[model samples]
Each structure stands twice: as structure tokens, then as C-alpha cells.
Target: MKRRFLPVAVAITASTALLLTGCGSSGGDDDSLGKAKGTGGGGEDASAPASPSPKPAGIKRPEVKLPKSFQVEFAGWTNSDPKLQAIMDDGKERLLASYAAIIKGDPQHSALAYYSEGDALRTGTAWVKGFSDRDLTLIGKGRVYQPQPRISPDGSGTLFYCVDEGKGSTKDTKTGKVTATPAGDAFVLYRTKLRKTDEGVWKTTMVQTERRACK
Candidate 1:
């Protein structure tokens, strides 16, 4: 043989040493680079700030409202899970109050408490788009669609049951006013959704009706 193979062993060990030194140098540079940014990717710097959380752009959500009767199904969620419960809860309160407001014939004032700024803007701009304001006033004032003699929901939205007087306006009131007879009307219930805003609290949503249809 030309010589013993021990020379190969020496070469291998030398290369290993160089590789180890290079790796050590690179690792040290990485640590220093992280330190320059004051990051805690790998350091004892407790001063490293925690990651910032995202802010919500809209009102938070609240809790779910179980339908009191066969009326309305009040339920939902917001894109932001963190604040959805609160938002839904607020919405429920507003929705319940909305009926009371309408019953009192002061929907505008009720709107303040029941809807968010965004909702009010839409409700105002629509000016009864989905609603026949005149009919609403007619039936609403007649108390045919009474919200309730009184409301009794907690901070959440209200659940109200009412009897509509089916008689037309041609009948006479106790006086000559011609108030119709108190015909048996359908029993109805409703639930409102509420939310919180910068100006104050509001009902961002509303759902109402008896689960069972009017006979």
C-alpha cells in the first residue's frame, strides 16, 4: 500500500472542525440580529412586547335569546368572537325596548335606545321602506298591535304576548268615536337584538313574531 489510511482520518477531522466553527459563527450572528430588533425569539429580554391584538371595527355581539313562545327566534354571532356575547346582549335589550317604544308611539325616542348609529341612519334613510309607516301608525295607535299592557323582560330583549282586537274601525267606542268591537285577535310575541356603540347602546338587529301563525 502507498501508506496507511490514517491521513484520511486527519482530513475528515479538520473539515469537521471548520464546519463546526462556521455553524457556531452563524448562530451567534443570528442571535445578535435578533437582539438588534429587541425580539425574544431566543433571548432573556423580558422587555419584548407581546403581540398586539386586532381591534374590532364594529359593535360587539351579545348573548342568545331563547324564543319565549312560538313567536320569534332571536339568535346570532359576530365576526369578532371576543366581544360577540356583549354585543348580542346589548342588541337583545334594545330589541325588547323597541316594542315598548312603538307601543308608547315614540319610536324615534325608542330608536335612540334600540338601534346603533348605523342602524338609525339606515332606518331614517329608509323612511319606512320595508314598513308602511301610515299603516303602522294606524294599527299601532289603535292598540290593535299592542306591544303589551306592560313589559317584563330582564336586561335582555322583551318577550311580549298580546291579543289583537279584530274589529274594524266602524264600531263605536264607549263614546260615539265608533271604536270597533274587541274581536279576538291573534296572540303575538317578539324579541329584539341590541348592541353597544360609542354614542351609547343600540339594537343593531330585530326579529319578531309568534312561532305559531295567526289563525
Candidate 2:
């Protein structure tokens, strides 16, 4: 998904420092998604539990949680090949980690660092910061579907997916006012680069997004 800024009354001088539109991008680091830096502080929510589903062996997974106000749905996440499936799983987790950071108002969330790195990390950090800077948080639901995973002989990987933000919106962290996003701004396509670490973690290294690329 590409970066989509909140529709708040406040004017954003930088277009790249924003939140996920329907699609996810590499935050706002690249021209496609725009750029910004993330800020704030917090830790994993103790009430939330780690995903109960089995993950690839030897991979250290972080516990990701979203508040009751926010929800994300993933479609078609399975793959016949274990390696490719691992990529899909990690890719999903990375996106979740990003949202988790934003919701907790913490740009330095450990899960974000655990799931992403390099340009992807910088972009995500900026995106999360954009919200924290404005005292904004997300509410409602977003959907991620149609995952397409590819593996390179050199060992790097890529995952492409679609996001629907039509049902999502932003809420004021303090006043609790909610701003609705236009449906026209929903639906985005995202491409992400991944590399497996020695610890067997698939870290997102880069991300690109296209606006209105999907229905």
C-alpha cells in the first residue's frame, strides 16, 4: 500500500510523511510513497497474545497486537512451498508490526524493527511518526489480500499485495474525533523486498506502492 495522509484539518507540508492509504508502501522514503520520520514511545501491549498459528522453524517472531478500535484482515495467505509461505507469513507480520507501532504511538516499536529494515524501516518509522506528531491514531478496519510471493535464486524475495482502506479512518488521540477517508482513496497495490537473516527472519528491506491500483 502507498502512504496516504490523514484527512485532518491540519495541513501536512510534506506529502510523503503520511499513513497507509488502502495499499502499503515503504512508508514515504521513496517517491512512490512519500517520506517522513516516526516518533513517540511505547511497548508491546501485555494483554495481546502472540499469533497462535505455527511459523517457520527457527524464526523468532514478535507478539503483535492491535487495539479494539483497529483491525486488519488478510486474504489468501497460504502457499504450497514452505519457503514461499514463510515469505508470505513474514510479509504479513511486517505489515502488522507497522500498524502495531502506529496504534501504540511509538515510532520506536520493537516489532517494527524486528520485521523491517533499511528503507522499509525508515519509511515505516516516518509514517508512524506522522500520526504521533499530530496526535492521531487509526480506527476501523483495513483488508490486505491477493498476496503474490516470488523467490530469487540469489536468496532475496518479493511480495506483492492489495489493501482496501475504504473502511478505515483516523481518530484524534486526545479529543477522540474521527475523520473519515474518501472511498476513492481506498485500494492500493504494494511491492516489498525481503531478505532472510541468518536467524531465519524475513525482514522487509524496501517497499513501493501504487495508488488506486486496485478496485
C-alpha TM-score for every candidate: 0.27, 0.77
User: How many residue pairs of model 2 clash at the backbone?
Assistant: 12
Can you write out model 2's per-residue Cα lDDT over 149-186, one digit (the tens) per residue? 87866688888776677778888879988887677666
Task: Give Cα distance to truth, residue 107, candidate 1, Å.
Answer: 2.6
Winning candidate number (lDDT): 2
> Model 1: what TM-score?
0.27
What C-alpha lDDT do the candidate models reach, one value each?
A: 0.29, 0.69
The per-candidate count of clashes, in order, stands at: 27, 12
